[model samples]
Every structure is written in structure tokens, then in C-alpha cells.
Target: MTDTQEHTWGERYADSLMNTFGQPKLVLTRGAGAHVWDTDGKEYVDLLGGIAVNALGHAHPALVEAVTAQLGTLGHISNFFASEPQVRLAEKLLALLDAGPGKVFFTNSGAEANEAAFKLTRRTGRTHVVAAQGGFHGRTMGALALTSKEAYRAPFEPLPGDVTFVPYGDAEALAAAVTDRTAAILLEPMQGEAGVVTPPKGYLAAARTIADEHGALLWLDEIQTGLGRTGRWFAHHSAGVTPDIVTVAKGLAGGIPIGACIGVGESGTLLEPGNHGTTFGGNPVACAAALAVIGTIETDGLLEHVTALGQKLRDGLAADPRVTEVRGEGLLIGLDLAAEVSAAVTAGALAHGFIINNPTPHRIRLAPPLVLTQDDAEAFLTAWPAILDEAFEGQS
Candidate 1:
């Protein structure tokens, strides 16, 4: 296709779609594994993996077969009735957590999962939640209230009130803010939207202790870092603390749009009858897709692959002096640039037939598919120097 053809689609998209996402970067036609082809037939290595949602990569046979088979058999059966896949998925998630007895409430997205958790916290007879600054939970009103970003929160004021924000990774700050009145102390094992910022060692353990001290629920939003993205079933696994509440989505269903809010131990009984509900929450097809994703991760040994590849990518990317820092675990990688050229770097990367993301002016994040090949990783590493050269062409 010609440039005009692409421009026509862009114009049509602007007219037809909402302006929430600004503009579509490319008119992607199809994808296989870690590669995608644009309408122009240009192939690019997909490093963002649909913003960390495509755990098994594009069009994996397991995910495709599971979704197709389930849809053909039984697709949507509202929450009024239960399905085998739904119950099995809930059990699988609990087994993965291995955090004693727990109950799962399914949703269609991460925001909905956090919303359910927010309401569950209210069941404890408290409304005050102390969430860390720089944490990105979700965009729903309740999740938005838990998020500390002023810009995202400012647009919708009078949000569920009494949510306190404290500096991330600071045990003293968290301890000072949480009290008996606090219902939950929410933290992301690793801040994804905030350029994949990671907390200090023992930060989550500290948060667990603080929450316990105040009798508050420890809620970890593992939306971005969970499901093998961090080389573990859950990012909080490394901290060795059992949280009362856990919210997960993103890669849960390998891009089939599923989220879960898991309440542990006594917290599971807080939300009794007539508490909350969803129409399309636990549909059989989505549940099957999630089960397939988990099965593949285990059978294919993708967690070990993610751990090794993540380290390689981090090391290779950090070889350049322009890269000031590298953070995150497993396939979720983020690096800082010495200069404010992340936009230029992203553009340069695209021109070189690789897709990357610039979350901030000086930060780039890469959450590639767990199935990303060693060849693709080497390709990106080999092109790293030249890409930076183009991005920093006119810089000091």
C-alpha cells in the first residue's frame, strides 16, 4: 500500500474512533510470534507485546485453539450461571498464588478487577486506602482514586475520597500514613506505567508489615508484572509476603481480556451475598483462554526463558553509555536515556523495523512476548547503537 492509503485509514480512524489514544501508530494487519506486518507490508519486531498483554505472542496455537474451542462449545453464559472453565480458572489462579485459601472474582479488565477490590475493602468497614505515589492501578473511578497521578485524577474530581498517597518504596512514609482507619495499603510490586520503576529490596515486605501493623489489607496490583512477565507467576512472589488482596489482568488471558480480584483467607468472606456483580465477567471462552495461557507458560518453560532473556536484553541495552539505568524483571524491561531523546529513540527504532515504547521523555519500556526468540533479541541489541546514534544525532 502507498502512503496515501495509510493516510486514508488514519483519517477514517480519527473520524470514527474516540480521541482517547491520540492516534494509531500503525495499521497493523496481522501478526505471528513476535513479529507483525503493517498494511504497508512492512514487518517489525514487536517489543511492547501489546503493552505486556500478549504473553504467548500473536496468534499462538494454544490460545487460538482454546478460545475457538470454548466459543464453539459455550461462549457467553452470564454470571447468573457458572461454567466449568470459570471455576477451573479460579482454582488455577489460587494454585499459582499458593497463598493458602482464597477466592477469585473475575472481570473483563484490570480496572474492573481493582474496582471489585476497592468495593471489597469497603466491606471491612473502612474507606481509607493508602496507595503509593507513582503507582498506576486502573482508570475506573475506584481504581483512579487509588492511583496517585494528579493529571489522571484531576480530570475526575470528588472521586472515592479518603485515599492517601505516599512515596513509593519508603517504609517510613507508608508506616506514617497507614493507620487503624485504613482499609488497605495498595502497592504495585513494580510500577509499570511509571517507566517500570522497581521498589527497593524488601519494600513489599515492609508494606506487608505496615499493613499488618495497622490491620489493613495489603493489596498488590500485579496487572503488569504478573503472569510470567516478571519470571514468576506473580511479582510479589519474590517478596515472600502473603497479601490479603491481589488484582491481576493484562496478560492473564493472553489478550483475551480477563482480570481477577483474589481475596485471601478471611478477606474472601467479606464480600457476601448481594455485594457486587458483572454481566460478562466469567464467560467460558475468556476463562479457557486464561487456562491455556497458564498451561503453555508451564509446559513450555516460558518463565525460565523470560528470566534469562530479560537479563540478556537488560545487559545488552545497558551496554550503551546513553542508557543510564535499566530496571524491571523478566520480560518487563525499562531503561533510562542520558538525554531527553526517548521519543527520538522510539522513532528511530521504528524506522529500523523494531517497535519500542517511550513512557516518559527520558524513559523507554519493553515488555516483549515471553515467546520472543533469541534471534529477535540479538537483532534489537545489534541495532541498538545505530538507533541511539540516529536519536542522539544533534544532541550534546
Candidate 2:
């Protein structure tokens, strides 16, 4: 297809699709490995990795085979019956979390998974939840209440109230806000949507101590940083603290839609029968895809690859003077630009055959696939200075 045809499709997209996400960036037709081609056949390295959802990269044979075989055998079974893949995936997640005797509630997306967790917290016989500023749980009502972004929560006022927002990474503020009345304390091990912001050392451990003191459930939103994205089974692993509740999605199924709310120890039994339910939450096909993703990560050792490549990319990206700071772990990287040129930088990267994200005016984030090649990383670093130059020039 030609550029003109691609432009025509973009117009059609504007006409047909909802305006929630604004204009489409590119009309992507297909992807393979860590690369994608737009409708016009323009090739680009996918540094964002479908916003960190494509764990094994595009068209991974393991993911494809699993989804295909499962669909052929049995596709959607309502929550009335049990499926092998669903139970197996649940067990696998528990093992990865290292949480003994937990329960799992699967959902179709991150927001839905968070919704399930939110509902589970309600069963604690308390109504108050304490979350952190700059933390993003999801867009749903219950999850939105926990999210601290005023822009996201403003239009939808009168949200489910009794939620408190505290400064992230500040154990003191968290301790002050959380008390015996609090039902749960929610946090993201690494704040992903906030430009991959990392918390202070020992913050998660402090949260665990505080939650325990108040008899509040500790919940970590690991949707963006879990399942080997942070070079471990979970980001909080490095902190060596176990959360009472953990929400995971966005790579759980490697690209297939799946999310899970896991409750550890006694918290696992909080949501009893008839407390909550979903129609298509634990679909067999999605569970099978998740199993394949977990199996591949364990067998192929992508975690080590992500760790080494991430360090290489971070070191290289920071070598440029325009980068003020670099943060995050593994493939989930965020860098601060010297100026508010992240939008221009992202545009310039696309023009130079790279895909990136600008979550804020001055923050450029990269959550590339775990399977990204070293060659691709080197190429991006090689082009980094030029991309910065073009972006700054555009700003001027």
C-alpha cells in the first residue's frame, strides 16, 4: 500500500472509531518480532511493544500455536464450568508470585482485573482505600477512584468516595493516611503510566509493614511490570516483599487479552461464592495463551535477556546529553528530555523508523518487547542523537 492509501484509511478510522484516544498514530497492518509495518509498508522498530503487552513480540510461534490449538479444542466456556487451561494458568501465576494457597480471578483487561481486586477489598468489611499519587490503576469507576490523576478523575466526579491519595515513595505520608479503618493500600511497584517512575528504596517493604500494622490488605498493581518485564517474575521481587493482593495483565497472555487478580493467604478467601463473578473472565483460550507465555519465558530465559539489554539501552540512551535522567528496570525504560520535546522526539523517532511513547511533555518511555534483538537496541542508540537533534530543531 502507498502513503496516500494509508492516509485514506486514517481518515476512515477517524470517521468510524470513537474519539476516546484522539487520532490514530499509525494504521499498523502487521508486526513480526520487534518490528511493525504500517499500512503504507513503512517499517519501524516497535520500542513500545504495544504499550508493554506483547511480551514475546509479534507473531511468536508459541503464542500462536497455543491460541490456535486451544480455540480448536474448546473456546469460550461460561464461568459455570471449569477448564484445564484456566486452572493451570491460575496455578502457574501462584507459583510465579510465590504466594502459597492463593485464589485467582481472571479478567479480560487490566482495568477489569483491578475492578475485581477493588471488589475483593470491599469484602474486607471496610470501605476506605489509600492509594498513591502518580499511580494509575485503571479507567474503570472503582479503579479510577484509586488512580490519583485529577485529569482522569475530574470529568467523572462523584466517584466512589472514601479513597485517600498519598505521595508515592513516601512511607511517612502512607503511614499517616493508612489506619485501622483502611480496607486496602494500593500501589504500583513501579509507576508505569507516570513515565515509568520508580519508587524510593525500601518503599514497598515499608508499605507492607504499615499495612500489617493497620490490618489493611497490601495490593500491588503489577500489570505493567510483572511477568518478566522487569527481569523478574515480578518487580516487587527485588524488594523482597510479598503483597496480600497482586493484579497482573498486559503480557500475561503475551498479546491475547487476559488479566488476573490474585489474593494471597487469608486474603485469597475474602471473595467467597456469590460475592462477584464475570461472564468471559476465565476464557479457556486466553488462559492457554497465558500458559504458553509463562512456559516460553521460563524455557527461553528472556528475563536475563531483558536485564542485560535493558542495561545496555539505558547506558546508551543516557550517554546523550539531552537526556536528563533515566529510570526503570529491564525493558520498561523512561528517560527525561532536557526540554519539553518528547512529542517531537516521538514523532522524529517514527520518521526515523522507530516507535516510542511520550507519556508526558518531557518524558519519553520505551517498553520494548523482551525478545528485542541486540542489533535493534544498537540501531536505536546509534540514531538517538540524531532523533534528539531533529526533535529540538522542531521545537525551535
- Give the C-alpha miss distance for residue 336 in model 2, angstroms: 0.7
Query: Which stretches of candidate 1 lie above 4 Å from their native place?
Result: none
TM-score of every prediction relative to native:
0.99, 0.99
Candidate 1, residues 36-137: lDDT per residue as tens digits? 999999999999999999999999999999999999999998988999999999999999999999999999999999999999999999989999889998
Q: What is the per-residue lDDT of model 2 for residues 167-266, given as tens digits with 9 covering 90 to 100? A: 9999999999998999999999999999999999999999999999999999999999999999999999999998999999998998899999999998
Q: How many clashing pairs in candidate 2?
A: 0
Off by over 4 Å in 2: none
